[model samples]
Target: MELTVSPAPHIHDNLTVSKCMYNVIIALLPAFAVSLYFFGIGALIVTLSSILSCVIVEYLIQKYLLKEKPSIGNGSAILTGLLLAFNLPSNLPIWIVVIGSIVAIGIAKMSFGGLGNNLFNPALAGRVFLLISFPTQMTQWPRPIVSRWNYTDTETGATLLSKLKEEGSQWIEQIDIANLWIGNQGGSLGEVGAIALLIGFAYLLYRKIISWHIPVSILLTVFLFSFVLACGQETGNMQNIPMWQYAFDFALIQLLSGGLLLGAIYMATDYVTSPMTSKGMIIYGIGIGILTVVIRQWGGYPEGVSFAILIMNAFTPLINNYIKPKRFGNHRS
Candidate 1:
C-alpha cells in the first residue's frame, strides 16, 4: 500500500502592512482634529503640504531610483508625512516643509533600502535634520490661531520649555496647565495638546496596534525621575532653588510640555526602528526617558524627545540581538 501525505497547514492572519499603517493614521486623527481646532487653517495647510510632498517624493524615488511603481498605497508614506508635519512648527515655511518631506521619504526611508529596512524613524530623522539646518526657523513656534497663509504681526509665543530655559522656575509659575492640555500653548503642531495625544493613544490601545509596555514605561520613568529631582530641589540639594508650593509642577512640566507624549506613543514605538522583545522595549523606553529628562533638565535643547528616540533607534539592533525571545519548552542552558 502506498500512502501520500499532504503539505502541512499554513496559518495566515488577515492583517496587512497597509492595514497596520492605516490603523496608525486613524489613531492620529483625534490629535489632528484637536490641532486644527486650536491652530486653525495653518495647521491643516502644513499637514496637507507635508503629505503631498512626501507622496510626490516617494513616487519619484521609487519610479526613478528603485525602478518600481511607488507603494504610496501602503500608507507608510502618508504616516511619515503626517508625523513629519506634526513635529514641525506650524509657521515653518512651505518650502522647508517640502524639503523635510524629501529628506524623510527620499533620504531616510528610500535610501536605506526602503520601508522595512530603515534603521531610523524617517519622520524623526527628517525633523532632526531640519532642526539642525534651520535652528531659528524650526524653533520659532507660531502663536496659536494665527494664519500661516497671511503673515500677521502676532506675539512670538514661547513654548513651555523655552520659557523654562529662558526664565527657569520664575516662568513655570505663570503657565496654565489647562492651556497646555488644550493646545493653547506654543509647541510643535501635534505635540501641543496633551489631551488630544492621550485620546489618540487610547484609540491605538483599543485597536491593539501597539502594546502598553513602551509608552507606559517611558511616561513612568519620566514622572519618577522628575519627582525625585523636584524633591531634591525642595531640600535645597539639587539647584539651591526655592521650592514651589506644589511639588508636582515638574511632573506636569514633563507630561504636558513638549513632544514627550507624541514621541513615546508614536515615534518610539516604530516597529522597524524599535526592539522586538518585551524586555528590549522596556529597556529602550527607560533609556529614552532618561535621555529626554537629561536633555530637558541640563542639555542645551529644551526638548529632547526627538533626539532621544533617534538615539534609541540606533541601538535597536543591538537590543534585539541580546534580548532574544526564549523558545517554547526549552530548558535554560
Candidate 2:
C-alpha cells in the first residue's frame, strides 16, 4: 500500500473564489435594479463604465505591469466596479468613474497583492478618493425619477443627512420614511434604496455567502446609539407623537437613511478586510457603527460609512491578533 502525505485534513467543499464573487453580484442585482429605476440612463452608464474600467485596469495591471496571467475571469474586478459605482452619484462623469475604477483596481487591489491581500475595501477606497478629489461632483446627488434622463444636467438636491445638518432636527418631521425605504429619495445610487439593499442582504444570508454577525451588529449598534442621541436631544414634538416614539423614529431614520444599510450589509462585510472570528466581527462592526454615527453627527462629512468601514479595515489585523480564534478539534490538556 502506498501512503500519500499532504497538508492537514484537506477537506474541501465546492465553494470557490469565483462562486463567492458571483454570489455577491447576484445579491447586488436588486439594488442595481433600484438604481436604474430611480437614476435611469445615468445609472446604466456609470455602472457599465465602472465595471469595464475595473476589469480592463486589473487585466492590464496583471498582464503588463505584474508580468502575470490576468485573473479577470474570477469576477473580483466586476464586483469591485459594481460596488464602486454603487458608492458614486449617478450623474458623475464617465471620466471620473473610469478614474475611480483605476484607483479601486490598480491602487487599492493589485498594488496590495490583489484581491485577498488588500487591507482596505477597494470600492470604498476609490469612492473616498473621488470624494476628496472631486468634492462638488461627488456631493451633487440628482433628484430621483425626475432627473433620471438628464445625466450631467440632472437637477440635484441635498441628502437627508445634509438636510438634517443644514436645517436642524425640524426637517426630520417632513421626511417621508416610506419614501426613504422605497428608493424615492435623493441620494447616491445605493443610498436611496434601503428596501432593495435589505432584500440583497437577505439573499446573501440565505445563500450562506456571509454570516449575520457583522451586518446585524453594525445595524444594532447604530440603532441603539442613535436612539440614545435622539433621547438626549430636546426637539419639539412637531408631529405630536410621544417622545419615545419620536426617539424610535429618529433611530429608524438613521438606520434606513443614506448609505447605512448599504455599508453595513455589503461593504463592511467584505471577507478580506473584516475580522475572522465571530467575536472580532462584532467588535469590528461596533467600531464601524460608532464611527459612522459620530461622523454623521459631528464630523464635517454628511456621510461616514465609507470612512468608517475603511478605518475599521485598517484595524482588522490588530483585532485578529487580539481576538484569536480557538483551534479546531480536541486537544489533551
How high is each candidate's TM-score? 0.91, 0.96
For model 2 the TM-score comes to 0.96
lDDT by residue for model 2 (1-333), tens? 999899874898888899999999999998999999999999999999999999999999999999999999999999999999999999999999999999999999999999899999999999999999999999999999999888999999889889987776787789889998889988888887888898999999998989999999999999999999988877755657677877898899899888999899989999999999999999999999999999999999988999999999999999999997676774743
Show pairs that collide, candidate 1: none
Residues 194-217 of candidate 1: C-alpha lDDT, one tens digit per residue: 888888899888887889989989
lDDT of 2: 0.92
Off by over 4 Å in 2: 1-5, 237-239, 329-333
lDDT at 302, model 1: 93
At residue 34, give the lDDT of candidate 1.
Answer: 76
Compute the lDDT for candidate 1.
0.85
Choose the strongest candidate by TM-score.
2
